[model samples]
Target chain A: MARFKLTIEYDGRPYVGWQRQDNGPTVQAVLEDAFAEFAHGEEITVFGSGRTDAGVHAKGQVAHVDLARPMTSDALQAALNHFLKVRETGISILKIEEVDAEFNARFSAKGRHYLYRIINRRGPLSFDRGLAWHVIRPLDAEAMNEAGQRLIGTHDFTTFRHVECQAKSPVKTLDYLRIERHGEEIHMLAGARSFLHHQIRSMIGTLELVGCGKWTADDVTAALEARDRAALGLNAPPDGLYFLRVDY
Target chain B: MARFKLTIEYDGRPYVGWQRQDNGPTVQAVLEDAFAEFAHGEEITVFGSGRTDAGVHAKGQVAHVDLARPMTSDALQAALNHFLKVRETGISILKIEEVDAEFNARFSAKGRHYLYRIINRRGPLSFDRGLAWHVIRPLDAEAMNEAGQRLIGTHDFTTFRHVECQAKSPVKTLDYLRIERHGEEIHMLAGARSFLHHQIRSMIGTLELVGCGKWTADDVTAALEARDRAALGLNAPPDGLYFLRVDY
Candidate 1:
């Protein structure tokens, strides 16, 4: 058996998140099926670094899959992409390379990077309608950044964690959270060793209140200290979130 | 009558073109209908700076319209946008301002700026399928820029002009033609007072040959000097082209 690591990109609009579920198509099921086609109907299981909710895009999502048949990494990548294109799937295999069997896409992950886009304009979105979060009121990105800074460092993120999160503990080290304005859009970049379910989106939704002068930075700190899910302000939608990449 | 100038943005994938047609829906027709709804059935003509072909997007397309009834620019913009949203059109009114009665969207424009996007990668497109042109082979941006420079200044552009172009003269000055690589994508910015129909796409398609080392700068010069439509190398698809903005 040969194990290969694959870097994938997807629009995430047509799937039921990254995981395979019977409800609808998913990124994982799509990749596995594409691999099975070239593997001559050999059942293939592909493991991902993490799961992203439905409507969340990915510029670079890493995964690992083991194949019973041997083939050049380049050939396999090309073949998989060919099947994906033919199937009209939104997923694309960016790169593929051989990896040690010991490498686990889920367990060996070091860091995760995510980007959330917000279109801060009064006008409704046209070109970026489904690709970004649209906020009608004017936003103070500087205020949002200041509030985001309060969430840095190791802490109990229970306030931002989803109630249905499967993680046992809410304590996680947040490496960085930086927010900046790019013309009409607000981009927030967050990095961490790991995140609880809906943690990033929860934080962003609370910070948006600060951006619009509704909540102060002290409010964000208070919410974190509460360590209660009910203390959270709001949960940002999945449309604007993107799993940028995983760092090992 | 009050004249209003509109800065518009649109995802042109659904429209027939900028101009109104009997064949199908168009950007012009959508705007006209929206205005008519709010104008109490008064006939309103929205004149665009230039007509963009089908499947060509616009980030900053400019237009002008005359209203028989007096209304604040802001209110008019808001009403039109509300109607557009209700109709689910992929067009947005970025900005609206009252202009001089003499202002003309087409004749008064001093220059037009356009952008062409080329995704230079081996993978098939996903998120940017219709938003960009996918090129499998490697491209040399420097060579494309070098060849583009030769097209600048006043010259007879018959070679690049479309056979169906209705321009009275084939002579037009190209203000600038710049090629730059942005990550995995190649962006080409072209500026001119006016362009013959299909001139920009024709130039980009030919420059692509130079970018892939299939043609030299001298070859581009020869094509331009030939001043014949038969000498043109290629006419790029309308998918990657964007009507960026118009200067008054």
Candidate 2:
């Protein structure tokens, strides 16, 4: 079996999530169905680096597939894209590369990057409704940045993880957290080796309070120290979250 | 009667056009219906600076409205937007202000600014599907810009005007036509006092030929001097066109 790594980009608005399920359409099911045509009717199962909730977009999501027949990277990409186009699934196979069998899409990942987009404008969104979070009031990116720094480095993220997260530990090392403002758009970039479910959303929800002048850096620190889910300030919606990259 | 000016933005995916037509729903009809809710059943007509075709978006479209009942600008804006939201028309009133009775939205405009977006890359659009024109082949914006300069200044733009254009004269002065490249996106900014039907799109379509090295600057001049609609190369789709703003 030849292992191939595929980088993908997709709009998550019409999807259940990255995983396969019986209830509704998913990115995984669509990819698998597309891959079947190129695999001579052999069902293909693709393993994703991680799961993204419904309505969470991905610019550089990574996955891996094992093909029984050897094929060039270009042929694989073209064929996969052709099948995807037929479905109009809003998924694109950005690139494909051959990789060693030892490289696991999920377990071998080194780090992950996520971006949260917020449009802090008085105008309600028209073109960017599902692509960005609209915050009616103006945000203080400087204040958000200060509060973001308090959450960096390793810590027990119990206050941030979802109550139903299956991760064995609540501890996580957030390598970096940067808040940047470009005109009316505010972006939050987060990097970590791994994250418990809903960790990024929880952190952003709390940071938004700081941005709106409802919380301070000390308040974020207190929330972290609380080490309890009840201490979480908020959990941001999935509409504005994008899985930027999965580093290996 | 009180005169009010409104700054509007909308995603034009679901409407026929900006005018009132019996064939399908339009932006004007939606606004007029919303206005009736606030006017105590008195129907009102809105005069837009210009009309945008179906699927043509707007970031800052301007219009003027006359109300029989006097009200503050803020109250009018809020009520109009409140009524608009109930319908989920994918349109929003960004701002509103009181204006003089003599200020006609169509005639008082000194110039119009338009933006044509092109994603000149191989990647298929996921986030910007309807917002940008996707060209798979790489485009040379520099060449397109050079050819675009020929369309600037005063000229008989008969070749660029649509067949159904109702303008009395074909001679029009184009203030500027600029082509700019940012990463994989190419933006064409066109400015003029007014435009003939499909004029901007016609120019952009021909310039695309220039960008792909199929036409030269001299060819663009010849096409303009030809003064024949048959000499036109193409008329770009309305999907990539945006009615950016009107300068009073």
Candidate 3:
């Protein structure tokens, strides 16, 4: 058996999420099925770096899988893409490469990158309706960025963690956070070795309050100190979140 | 009556085209109906700068309409947007400006800018399926740009004009034509005071041949000199074309 690393891109709108589920289709299930077909009926398991919520997109999600069949990386990639296209799945195997047997997609030392997009305009969205969050009110990107700086280090992010999150610890170190305005859109980028569930969305939602003048940087610091979920502001919707890349 | 010049944006996938027709829904029909509702059942007509074929998107389409009822530009814009939103049309009135009574969306335009996108990759599209043209073959953008220079000046572009085009003459001057590669996508920008029906698409399709090394710059000149529709290489689909902007 050979282990291979797969770089994937997918429109997550159609899936239940990244993980396999009995309720509806998921990116994992689709990929497993495609890999099984490529392996000629052999059962296959695919491991992803992380689980993304429904309605979230991924430009470079990473995964690892083992196959009994021997094939070139290029051939495997092509075969997998062909199967995915035939099934009309929104998932695409962008690249595939042989990897060390010990490589684990979830546990390998790495960092995660995420991007959130907000269209700051009064007009309703046309082409980017589902692709971005449309904020009818004007946003102060600079203020948002200044407020976001409060969330930059190791802390017990209990206020940002979802109640249903299974992680044992509420503390996680946020390595990077930046906000910038590009034309009519405001983009927020965040990076961390790991993140508590809903942390990024929670922080973004709170920062939006600062952007629209509903809150201040001092308020953000106060909320972080509160360490209670109720202290968190609104949680940003998943529509604007994208799993940009996973760094190894 | 007060005349207003409107800047609009739309995702043209669901509409028949820009023009109103009894055969199916159209952007023009949608706008007219929304305006009528905003005008309290008053009959209204919305004139567009140009007619875009089915599945052509627009970022900055211009139009002019006369209304007997006087209202602030903001009020008019907000009213129209509310009606359009209620109807769930993928159209947005980006801006509204009170204009002179003589201003015409079509006739007063001094220039029109168009953008065409092509995704050169082997993978089948997911998010961009209907948003761009997907070409599997590798493209040489420099070659295409070099060949496009042949179509920049005034010429009798009979070979590039659509067979059913209603233009009085085939002679037209193209002010600008450029091809550039942006990462995995190739963007083609074209400008002219006016264009024959399908002229941009026709030229793009022919240039694609040059991009793939199937045709040369000399071949483009030869095709243009042929002055026959049959001499055209190919006609690109409208999916990747966007009526970018109009200058009056």
lDDT of 2 by residue, B87-201 (tens): 3788888889999999999999999999999988665677777888888777899999989999999999999999899999999999999999998789999999999999999
Cα misplacement distance, residue A60 of candidate 1 (Å): 0.8
For candidate 1, give the lDDT: 0.92
User: Residue by residue across A1-248, what tens digits does model 3's lDDT show?
Assistant: 99999989898778779999899999999999898887788889999999998888888899999888778998988999988983378788878999999999899948999999999987788887767888988999999999999999999999999999999999999999999999889999999998888888899999999999999999998899999999998899887889988888
Q: What is the lDDT of residue A102 in candidate 3?
A: 97
lDDT of 3 at A229: 94
Worst window of 10 by summed lDDT in candidate 2 chain B: B121-130
Clashes (backbone N, CA, C under 3 Å), per candidate, total 0, 0, 0
List of clashing residue pairs for candidate 2:
none
Model 2: lDDT of residue B240 = 88
Q: For candidate 1, give fnat to 2 decimals.
A: 0.62
Model 1 regions lying over 4 Å from their true place? none
DockQ of 3: 0.49
Q: Chain A in model 2: its TM-score?
A: 0.98
List DockQ, one per candidate, in order.
0.57, 0.42, 0.49
lDDT of 1 by residue, A79-105 (tens): 999888823888898889999999988
* lDDT (10s digit) by residue, model 2, range A142-229: 9999899999999999999999999999999999999999987999999999999999999999999999988889999999999999
